[model samples]
Target chain A: MPAGASTRAGSILAKPDHRYAAVSILPSVLVVFAVVIYPLIYAVMMSFRDSRMGVLGGFIGLANYARLFSDVEFRLAIVRTLVLTVIAVALVIVISLGVAMVVNERFRGSSFIKLALLLPYALPGTLSALIWRWMYDPSYGILNAVLYHTGFIKEYVTFTGDPRTAMGAIILAHVWKFVPYSAFLFVAGLSSIPPGLYEAARIDGASSLTIFRKITLPLLAPAMQLALIVQTVFAVLYHFGLVYIITGGGPGRATTTLPWYVYSETFRFMQFGRGSAAAVVLALIMLVFIYVYLVALSPKERTVS
Target chain B: MRRQDTISGRRRRKAVWLALMTVLIGMYLLFPLVWMALSSFQDERVLQSRPPRVLLTPDIFTLDHYNFLLTGRMPETGIMVQAMYTMSGTYVLPSVVNSLVIAVTVTLGNLILGIPAAHAFARVRFRGNRTLFMALFATRLLPALSIVVPMFIIVSRIGLLDTKLALMVIYLAITLPFTLWLLRGYFAHVPRELEEAARVDGAGRFTVLWRIVLPVAKPGLIASAVFAFMLSYGEFPFALILTQSLASRTMPALMAGIGYYGSSRGMVAAASVLSFAPPLVLAALFRRQLIDGLTQRFE
Candidate 1:
């Protein structure tokens, strides 16, 4: 819209239709509030108690939080979740950007590969976990078979079974499955970078690397930021399916991240209080503040402009 | 002349690089899936043979495992029978239906709720509009991790556990925020002048929205619907926790159970092929709108 038109619209909106807006928007606001806050309140309240095995005992008031902080498994799960999310998000971003850059080149028959991109992201995470688990299987597994035949390893090795390599293996599956979606984000970013800038840069005697660093990299910041945030949230939280299927929190708690801990603590051990606390302390509370900052920073500025 | 020659040389180098990267990345993106789909057709002996022979030869394959899954045709004296007897096994087809019902319901739920809410966010000026919009967007970012613990308990307490209704409500909560935020962005991009002109011409707000905004925002609607369906279909943790049987268990939850149970490798392979088809087909068909929804509506 023109600035004048928007200003006139703003003035018209300033008085009469506030009621209309309220009426229209109320159901969604209430729905989001109820959906988010309702379960949140239940979890938060449960976390403050000394609950056990589906039984709500007296409120312990931060005892669950204290216990989770002291427990080695809880503490390690937090570190593992953070580290894995960081590493996975970084790898996914870099790989997706490369894929996106290649896709943007519009080389012969690239659209076929573009369609292929959706396969990894579209497949259920459990299925990826299943496929990768088979690939990583020590005996009777394709990966071990290929490596042994090709002489990459002296013997069949356990990828998800060994404590040392389990996280690395999970991270590989995570990157493979996640790259395509965010790659599309970067493709969008690449498409939006005006072609004239690159044309002018080429005409100005700039090198390819220089053009990329000066124009492409900087212009892609919004997409990069969004991907980084979204993928971080995605990796930290949603890898539940992947980890649950692939390692089951692993060979001796080796791959147990925060979500796994939450599951085991609440559901497995029936330690509801501790589980809820692990969820709030390690994951949700920290992410809530980050999301609030994101909300402040985006969309409204772009939409109004 | 020297610059032109160098440019052609760079072009040759890039073509080689592009081709190499394309093949390498394509292999990485596709090989595992193609391997799995191919493995689905083979019998256990062939798939698990030494060095794991991946035979796609049409004459060498068997559909017994698939027949077992789709039609309950028992595989003769094998793991499939034991798997069915021992574990909660191979409800692949039924679970896929369970996934579809929950996903479709959630998608419909999102559209019904999302359209009006998003419309108001885009066109209406009300008190606390940005604050409300921001909060809703933020909720979408909150992981199922936070909500699942309590959501499970609540569902169980209400005796909704093992019901598709449990999955539907949670999925609506899980997915609706995203639909609202994306549709809001799409609605904002719909030209306001036409809407304003319609309002002045005495069409009611709903009429303007249905006739004008919706037609323009069709891409976002499809994108939102597909997005909801995929997420609901792929959702694992909530479904796993809430549902115990194939009656309401989704494909992911059931597939995970099969994988975890050390079921026949070929059987798991067949199920993996079944699970991924819908989302991939939907994505490929709606390739334009899905990308446009993220890239164009995002603006």
Candidate 2:
């Protein structure tokens, strides 16, 4: 059978014109190869050699990897990245799910709320951090003002300056920026559930909570899993802008996630070999993340296949 | 009758609660943008006030920040004296134009390549199609940091660093995968019978795609276009690393350079609002297409 032949085509599967298809597909393949695949291979190779400021040095197999493991800061950065990723992903899921349910109710003004929800994510991440930076300003932040005026605080607090609240502040900005996208995912998930299922449950005298638990929660799992996995990847790899702008990964290295570590190591410290090695570790970690997602999705995928 | 009345009453209460919840969430989502807009309008001195002016009276609100950004003229009262000194002859507007250039060019590049490739993948099955599809999407799996060093080295070697062409090439990499995947779904959604009918009328492959399939897939095409635009417009990492000057630096990097409303808080706020205007407006107007494109099932 011709590969990927449509069902409409008869049993006499004619061979596809590979030349035509290849010609049509070559430009995109080449672009991606030059920009994405080639760079990736280069990065992997660079991880094996000692380089300084993009100049190649002698091949030092796994030396950078060894240093990455032994380095105290890199270890701490890994721990911090894991902590942030877990907490941020969890918060994003819960908050987005809750908001999705509310919006799915389709109450009056829901459309306006939907429009408003896209703002944070749509605005550039750097600017969102800046906006939140103003909101979180210690002496003159609107957040402090509102809290003090509302009698929730006794004094002005440095939200991003204190190590205790720095990462929390960053997480809050992240949630603000990311929740909309995840909420949209949940909304899509909710929309996909067959209305007949809910109607059937209601006809069977199911309570609202029972209907949700039995009919909604199980059905929403795929989208929920997708959102969680994607957000986890983002938390690990992205959020560099938030970390860079708000705290500069500062207040004593309080917010230096893995991406930030790569940035500072390679760009600031000019340790190209070490940075490339760290980047490889990050890529490996991400592979594990994707592998988990794949493993989780495999059963569903197999059923469909 | 009494039970019926009670059930309606319960629904009314639920609706009321939902409305309340939506209002609270909307405020949480909107207040930051509102604050930025307000700060942009207020005088720099007014912004520094303790408890910063929440409601703008006519007196505190002025267009000085915007005027300065637009005209390059400093206010006589010298509210942003320090900012003016630092930002004199700054190419804020030109830089934003550079951003537009990169975003528009990259978006067009993506669609041109993405549409044909997606059509090929969806319609013409060939050897290695599945493998190529997997590889194309796999490119997006790794973090941008993983390849930034190599990409930088590659771009600089070609001597395209800090040029819009450099940005176009890098952003093409960033946006093409998503565009290809989404447009492939769009192409697949076009009923096969439509193309076959056109072919029966003697239309060639390209003409069938161009005439019959594309018209039907226009909404999806627009959605993918918007997505491509926004990705390049708001992308930060590559923008930060690959470009160093106004020669090619986009809004995100430029805004970051302003130090998050540090000293020139007012001007930066204005620039932020200005920078966000196009994508935000596009997003608002095309909300439906964007949402459908994102949340639509490919399968």
Candidate 3:
């Protein structure tokens, strides 16, 4: 009788607690605001001013932006970064889509393939870059050894050392590490597509390629768009580790992509003003793409609706 | 009868072709890692030889690399522990510990803070909720490097530079948005009927959340936890800026250190193997959950 009474008493509660929602939400919101949003504003402001060894110098107005425009190295970095993004993102999309399509077939070993596909994405960028660096070692590197043994070449190719190949090598590593997530996303995208569509196409005597083009690819558009944007962002901004580890932006700054360029300029050269300016320019460029994509997509959405 | 035979033959051919394609793709994906692992088990002579030795003899194979790292006793020959320090100032074990601590702590913090916040957004239609959520979501668009300099200043001014706490805080900021976004969808999918029924029994919101919501959201919670752990484990740019020495430098930062050292490929390969092991194991174990979490969207 006492235990039953206790159980009944324990079941009773306070009010619905509307305030609990605010209490739960506010801390994370504040942290994100302080850490992400505030620093973004700070970075923008810092771009407009001069800074020396972490010291904020007097406001230089638009000089930093003006200087970034005139700077050849900065301009080159923009082009190089764009090329890297295009190639890496394109490769990732194509490879991942193919892999996703295959793995989604429910073959006997499809699960193992899926797991292997995600392994590279699971690795940290630093470790991935590190592993690739060892692989690219010209002297004792396995790549060269394999090439030689396969009768592909007589001499060991210095992949990261050669300017022509440095960016390519980095892009290959980037694609490898990033393809898994994109593939998995594509897999998800593929699953969302109704199987009935494929069945209808097959009944109409559609070939596999035609079926894929007409049904599968169209359905995967949204996922493809998301993956492209995310990959572009990473390819441009977050590839610091790969370049830093593999090439160190070497072979006469051949692979000195924007992030590495920013690091070298700011920390290595102590030109924090220009560094911030470069960062701002990069950010603005991304915003432009996003804005353009959204503007382009909204009209289409309206027309379809 | 002839048509049926042709169709069966074509199906068999297709199966063979598919099998071949799978092998080719698998090789492309696993080759680098397989090579890295194989190289790690070999000593310097076997590794440094021209036309790199794909097949290692018993004499060529050595546990010295792992022994040196795990036990801290130098090998009789080949690479030494001193080589890593002199070459690039890298210390493997401590950095591994540091990485583990940072990754685990950041994951915990994300779950604690992000889950409740996600719940708030998911369950309650509070005032300014959309605005707040939009603001949080918008932060994801900002490039990490854009705010990097400012983050450096913020960390240093607080006198937390080169500390694990700084990495944890920065990683928390890095990971929270994704976790909240992912878990919010999961939390919302949890049927309101369950909570409504629980509430009818005089249970409060917290009780409903603890009793009903969490258990249903376990897979999502686990996936987000792993995401946070991986992101923190692999993060480099912020770690590069904030950490000073091996004391606080995570595994990725140590890789950068080894890059500067540039001499001992064997040692670097060994370190790479160690770093790769954890994520590889975790991935194999939780691949299903990760796939579900990543592909999850508003149904």
Question: What is the lDDT for A147 in model 2?
Answer: 97
Q: After superposition, how far is residue A178 of candidate 2 from its true place, in Å?
A: 1.5
Q: Which portions of model 1 miss their true places by more than 4 Å?
A: A1-16, A288-305, B1-3, B76-87, B297-299
DockQ of 2: 0.63
Q: Using TM-score, rank the candidates from best to worst.
A: 2, 3, 1
Candidate 3: which pairs clash?
Answer: none
TM-score-superior candidate, 1 or 2: 2
Cα lDDT tens digits for candidate 1, A1-305:
22343444545354435645766777777766776789888888999998988688998999998888989888888789878988999999999999999989989746766777878877878889889988887877788898898999999998888999999989999999989878888988898889999999999999989998999988887787788777887787678887888888998999999888988888889998888988787556457546664775454334321
DockQ of each: 0.59, 0.63, 0.56
lDDT of each: 0.81, 0.82, 0.80
Worst 10 residues of 3 chain A by lDDT: A296-305
Give the Å shift of residue B236 in candidate 3: 0.2
lDDT of 2 by residue, A1-305 (tens): 24464454543233333444666688999998788778778888999998877568999998989888999889998888888888999999989888888878776776777787778767878889889888898878899998999999999999999999999999988988889889888988898788888888998999999987988988987787778777987787668888888899898899888889988989998988888888888888888888887787644542110
The alpha-carbon interface RMSD of model 3 comes to 3.4
lDDT of 3 by residue, A1-305 (tens): 11333333333222233366777887898888888878778878888997867578999998888887898988898899889989999999999898888888778757777877877878788878878877888887778877888899889999999988999999999999888888888988898899899999998999999998999987877777777777777777667788988888888988988788778888888778888888887778788767765665433332100
Q: What's the DockQ of model 3? A: 0.56
- What TM-score does each of the candidates earn? 0.92, 0.94, 0.92
Worst 10 residues of 1 chain A by lDDT: A1-10
